[model samples]
Target chain A: MLSTQENAIIIEDLKKSFKNLEVLKGVDLTVRRGNILALLGPNGAGKTTIIRILSTLLHPDNGNVFVNGFDIKTQPQEVRRSIGLTGQFADVDEYLTGLENLLMMGKLYHLSRSVITRRTEELLKKFDLTEAARRPVKTYSGGMRRKLDLAASLIAYPPIVFLDEPTSSLDPRSRLNVWETIKKLLNDGVTVLLTTQHLEEADFLADTIAVINDGRIIAEDTPGRLKSRVGKERLELVIKRQDDFERAVTVITGNDLSHNSAEKTVSLAIENGVNEIQGVLNQLAESGIEVDTLTLRKPTLDDVFMHFTGLKPDEGRNEAA
Target chain B: MNSQLVYKKAYWMAGDVWVLIVRSIKHIYKNYDQLLGLTIQPIMFMLLFRYVFGGAIVVDTGTYVNFLMAGILVQGLAFGSLTTSFSIATDLQRGIIDRLKTLPIASWAVMMGHVTGDLVRNGLQAFILISMGILVGFQPTASALEWIVIAVLIVLFTLAISWIAAIMGLLAKTIESVSWLGFLVIFPLSFASSAFVPTETMPAPLRVFAENQPFTHVIEAIRALTLNRPVGNHLWMALVWCFGIILVSIPIAGYLFRRHGGR
Candidate 1:
């Protein structure tokens, strides 16, 4: 019984802990209807834990959650009925054909036999698994299996779908394919909450990205705003000679310049990339410092994450990978 | 209104169980090798016991083969029920349990569906083992009505054991642990009972343990029914054992199943 004014999902100071480890530390979030909210975080930042709590698979130790306007603690069935969940792993039965997997999901949704049949056919076609419909999932490639997994979640046309790291292990092409499927869901007005460690994924797919670290949402905003919050585009100059580093730094001084001795590069945060780069090049040339390479780098989601968390993305990515 | 909702929920749960049962049965059909593995073990034990160990064991019956048929059926079922464990463990390991948990259906339906599927499989194994027994000169002296009773009792016993297996499946940390746990239980229970030899032949303490175990009662009841012996308290004892297992296991299994959060 969600009112029109209510958000698709709302959380208030949600807390969950396992034994001595507190995974989610009093987190709050709101996902509006028909929007894609990406929960971007490093491993063990409690991204999956939050998704699990929202999907009613795990209960929060304390605090309140409403999914489609139903309290998750007291009205779990109502919450479950309103949401579809595609877990981090592809959860389809390997022995069953792609068609049977979808049909089984449809049956669990309490759809009629005819409706299940029709929906199974439509989903198979939609996910581009029509050719592989009769094949057992064990024989499918990783991308096809993921597609079928997502299709299984949509069998009942739930108002909201939770994709937990849907493209975590997918190759570039397969990730794009899943992104296409997600866009289709958005086109149909189905709200989506996806968790990912990939900044590029959040940048491309999320309407609003929540950057989480150490069990807290450190920053939340649109991807553009998040990147801008870090700083504007950066101007990078790789000096041809190591001795020219000091001169390059002097030219880019008063512009928040950072020098990397190992890479022999000088990077500066700039308000205007073109004008700043022009002035720096003129200054460097007048000072007889030959630049090996110069490029204007736009701010990416990676920069946004590093700026908010104060930790390099690679530090977390290495452990997660 | 609350009662009405409860009834509706029950109705939907039953339907969910049926759907899951169908899915499991389809899996068995597709992977016929597992089913083949199930049927072959009992037949091999029958052959080995009939040929290798038949001459050494002394039985009061006309032929040891007749006495061994019931024993083989009980042993076969005890081992066959492990398939339930492996299947459940695989589901949990592969994240299917989590998917089922998110669905708008009763949680117990997942376990019920698996037990029901294993029941059908155990039934088929029983049918094949009995056929092999008759072919190998094993004879049953039960009347048609008594035979029906034996079949129902065996299926009921299988259902009870499968519930215990389901619990092991949920609690097992890995798929490999499931088989080890099954071996630990099945090896002792099947060997310690009167399944392969008479309790009288065992030493004093071993006899005490073997004579009182639940498997002995079930084997004794099935042997009496098959041998046309006098109707005895073994039948009631077997029913109690089966009912006792179900009563103890259903709640524990359901609790473990609900507690499992798919790792």
Candidate 2:
């Protein structure tokens, strides 16, 4: 919050393609120093591609990227020295013990042996992997593997860290554990760029949320501001009979209405939840369409996606490469 | 100032390579099954050739095991280099290579680590085969200086093959393909060369290839050095071949490693 003017990462018109499939169609982004930026996107939305390019693991075909004031193209070594990357898949050495993995990573950074040793111990204890420090990573569970992977990335105490879907496949409990760990990273004044498909994750952790779809950032703002922009509540109604579905659609006045004809359900954005619900019920009564169930909910990232793109999160562009 | 910076860069690169080498060596120690395989395979080859084929294969040397010793040592070392390809391919597949690439360390350290670790492994395997040869009827009549030269030649040959293996690993799409790729390249070189038998008895075409190829010269050089026979031009030819392989392989491997995580 104090360092909002200083940028840890700056990406400009980044474009990349795998063969003919353009993964990033001119992505421009920035991460403020000492802030958590959640790259919110569905699968194959170029979230991972952006992370890869930023980490210097992959090249961008076009545009400029700078990390910690070092150009990604001309000053890659400097950029690498300043950033740590924890990929979507746990990239730690399976044959190495958790402690050995951290030590190896620390040595790769050319840290002194004493610093490496102390950092290794500190990280192992911090991640709650002290008991399993001596065990090979192959023996670890998925959650433990992720924690170790994150720990390995932080061994060098890099200025910036990139986590690509850190909690994608974790169980509920394990997901919470990782969230807590990420919060600790933020508290320690580390800049974080984490990509996640989970709306709640982005809402809970991000200082700034950038919703990416179809290889472009559709929206970027503070979570509260983005929520306010997507201020309309959602009304969902499951109709009693399939025959009433057609009549129900005609009864809905909102142009942003989306319906599943097979399920006999209609969902639409409403400006006023209470008044709109009463109006909808009366209209449905007049139209002789009986609703089986109805629910009103606050707008989430899914609703934000629908409001912005007029497409559901899963309906975003998926390219095969 | 520029020269000093370059020297400093080189110094750090060496340290980086050494660190990665230690990591790679630790992998070999931890993977007991791989170590067991490395041990049992060459010993089995030594025993099989010394006992089963020793009677029929008549060599112009002192004993069958002595002639076979050089072949066995060179062949074992060549085969041991196959693990370099497998390890590199495994690292690539498992994203460890990406992790290494993302670090600020010199890019060449990754390959150097694997290659140097393999050199140590080949050295250890060579020591094992030589001890086993002595335990059997084999005799090496070289002096200490000759032994040193032989060790140098062996290490050079291991480095050459290991670099080529590194190239194969970088080119391979998967760990499974790395095995096939390594076998396709190394199998023919070890078999068609003067590894197990003299090139004179081989068919005219294979004899031509066996005589001209790198591995034959390496085996011949080691054989001459160990037997205290005239090395002739074999040592020069072997050195040229190994250096040639290394010069060609390093750049190709480096390029492939850069393009690796692009996928």
Candidate 3:
């Protein structure tokens, strides 16, 4: 058992329902202090619901949750004092200038007016919003709005932060910029619980990835361990001709292989990376099965997702959308 | 010791409410179009009533403008209360309420801030409309004390209506739906009461409704106070309606806010 000081968040059999739909069915999760735990899942997998419950916005019908050693249900005010929430949407007043928004949040947190003024200036500079501090948020770009929202959350400098898909809607360049900002938070020893549908985001940023599906966390492990659990590597060959594709499929004896006739490619899950590729090429050469190209690929987060959920990531996206 | 803790809690709650009130007021200032509409609409109503409908109507009082003054002021307040609904609905739609809820501030502060902001705004509108009334041949015979009492009555009425508007904002699914819902409530109350004309001139059933409703009692209380008429049961009835609304609407709005207001 971990001490409360070492754990940033703990959920014991948390359950919630909206009408007849049970969004979070008896689930337990934990985040260690100063670590980033990414809730990696597709849409409507209850990722946002879990964040909502931990943030004290939505009440759980059953179970207990603790944030920074405070009970979420009984001591919500203390929990709020210890944590900041950045929701999926950037929740800032469009009519107010960026500086006013941060100052308002600071005041609500019970900071002194002088402290609010000082912190607002520091945060605006830190988030690269100093030039736009006096401009209303309605005129801000989407990325700028998100940056201001994040700045608002950090005004009080809480020990824990909950980010619900902080970069889900940003372009690639802005997404990378947000990633850098999150890394800086980690350097400050802030415990972060982030949710994202993008596999690369979880793989790149999360210390531990929790794969959730249908309101359940199917797998929770380090990114390396999760990927390795699915398999070692894959060998994919693009055959040059249609007749050779059929011959190549016949020569590869393993049942762990799949072929696409349109792409004229065969992908095989392999235990040995380099040796497996060599053996496959030699076998195809012997069978007069000409190969256009061959390459070895490591197991990606996508494969880990499919292995645990039994559904491709894109399929889950379509169903939820 | 217990009293000290209660005082401390009250102090912090007041602080939170004040901060949020400032935010709400800033929103009003920034949206100059809304500010303009608040001023322009009442002036238009005053002109239309003083010119178009002034000559045709007859009252036992000094003049038609004097009889129409209190009704116009109440009408402006009723319309101004809809801004409460619209602002609250916009906040909920934009997820601002959710952000406020997650903070460590008092839970009731958001609604209080919005309600208090409406009081300030409606008070200003009432002042403007009264000036317009005086300019258009409307006369008042009230003393200094009577003017103070009239101001208090107006404040209480605004508080009551603003709470109801807050409830509408919470219940309506969309901002557009909130306006439609507000119109459905405000249009009938302002029109069916003694706002635009006397209730005695109406037919049997309509006159009964027009005479007995809360708005009629409120408008009549203000009218009698301003015109130096005999103080009647209208004053007490108006107080009952105002307190009753404030008492009832507060809990329902608070309940809906806690249950569905997001975390």
Q: How does residue A50 of candidate 3 score in lDDT? A: 89
Q: List-wise, what DockQ does each model earn?
A: 0.50, 0.53, 0.53
Chain B TM-scores of the candidates: 0.96, 0.94, 0.95
Cα lDDT of model 2 by residue, A1-321, tens digit: 222249998888999988888889999898989999999988888988888888887778999888888888888888888888886643998888999899989988889899999999999999999999999999999889999999999999999999988887889999899899889898789999999887789988999999999899999999878776676577889999988888888778773678889888898777776887798889999988889999887777678888789898878777632
Model 1: CAPRI class:
medium
Interface RMSD for every prediction, one decimal? 2.2, 1.9, 1.9
Instruction: Give me the runs in candidate 1 sitting further than 4 Å from their true place.
Output: A1-6, A229-302, A313-321, B2-7
In candidate 3 chain A, what residue range of length 10 has the lowest lDDT sum?
A: A312-321
Each model's TM-score, in the order given? 0.90, 0.89, 0.88
lDDT digits (tens) for residues A177-207 of candidate 3: 8787778888789999999987678878899
- Model 2, C-alpha of B62: deviation from truth (Å): 5.0
Candidate 2 ranges with C-alpha deviation above 4 Å: A1-5, A59-64, A224-240, A253-256, A269-304, A313-315, B2-7, B228-232
Quality of model 3 by C-alpha lDDT: 0.85
Clashing pairs in 3: A57-B263
DockQ of 2: 0.53
